[model samples]
Target: MSAPHGINPNIPHSARVYDYWLGGKDNFEADRRVAEQTMAAVPGIRESARNNRAFLGRAVRHLSRLGVRQFLDLGTGIPSQGNTHEVAQAEAPESRVVYVDNDPIVMAHARALLTSTPEGRTAYLEADVREPRTILEHPDTLATLDFTQPIALVMVAILMHISDADDPEGLVKAYAQALPAGSYLVLSHLTLDLIDKRTADDYVAATSSQAMHRTPRTGERISRYFDGFDLLEPGLVAVSKWRETPLFPDEPAWMYAGVGRKR
Candidate 1:
């Protein structure tokens, strides 16, 4: 079957692979192959994906309860249950959300499924995360979000794609500088901290053929991304342990997650 316009189903996309990990039916064979390979390498990867998603929901809900009604979700993946707008708007009907991603498939799926409440609004931006200014200046972003008010900047499990040379910290700081005080930065990243060198090498070998540009950073480095933000309770920890206590505490931490508000 031919893929949709502007989409090459033959080439695996990170977002689609992620959708496969989340058990969503929006992925193609290429994506499933990579996802399955990753699962084979890191047996706990699928569970870790679910945990990261749960962290997203928890962070958004926490910010909403704290009265943040606007959201700028960068690297917005394939829409599934508990999307940012869905979770935020459910808490406050007047919430406004701007979903941004560079992938055509992600934008298409988001536009079709990430609907907004009549009282709230949702806009999709076909943009890359590396260019924070482009995203902040996009007309769709300006139309959907208020720069003056607090906005939650959500970047989940996407930074690993950014190479170290790209200065991921500087990219994050650019966005942080643009956001108003009181805005929240909700971020989660893949890490190799709690696992052995062999396991990390195995994971890299499994996905290396997929042309994925991933860099799993240390928890300390990931925490530095939150520079000026005041981290909420239970500061940066395994995604499974962020706010939600884990049933299996012995599992190796595959990802680090946290929520912080600009100070």
Candidate 2:
């Protein structure tokens, strides 16, 4: 498919690659190629994406049932089925969602498809997660979300793009500090725990070529991101196992997922 204007279709973006894995047609040739490389490196990578998406749905639905009307989704990949808005608004039609992403293409697709119900609202911010200030201070974000009310800060399958130099933990703290008590933090991150070193290296190398740094963190490190927040039941576990019966219970987990509320 032809890329939207101002986007380079020649380069593979992690978001587009993820869309491809989810069986979406919003990816380019480069994205498909890199996605194939990662799949070859780890055959279950596709299932990993599916599991992450499922975790997102369950988390949002649970939050909505708990009366969370505001959601600030960071690093929202290419919009697909069961998006934050879809799941939240499905449960609560008054849900207000603000999706943030660095990829121009992802934002473009979001603008076209990530609409909210008439009782709710949805806004898009083309910003990097590293720039918490940009996302938190953006006019659209401010207009759509109220800092006083509880908001769900979603970081699904996105933190891996952040390098250690960026202090991913500190970054999460920066955003968390802005949230008031009772706010929720939903996070999911990639891990190399289940894959061989050679496969992990190969997958990382291919994604890195497109400036997609897939830094796999240990469960301890991933849990650190939820510091200062009270973990929900089941705490941190495999994305597929987060409050859901895993379809492949015996298979190793490729991503760690959790939900916590500000104390």
Tens digit per residue, CA lDDT, model 1, 7-96: 878788888888888889888888888888888888688888888888899999999999999999989999988999999998999999
Report every candidate's CA lDDT: 0.88, 0.89
Model 1 CA RMSD to the hidden true structure, in angstroms: 1.6
Ten residues in sequence with the least summed lDDT for candidate 2: 244-253
Which stretches of candidate 2 lie above 4 Å from their native place? 195-211, 247-250
Error of 1 at 148 (Å): 1.0
Model 2 Cα lDDT, one tens digit per residue, 1-263? 77678889887888889999999999999889988877876768888888888899999999999999999999999888899999998898999999999888888889999888999999999998999998899999999999999999999988888999999999999999999999999999998776678777766665565555678899889999999999998999888878866544425468889999999
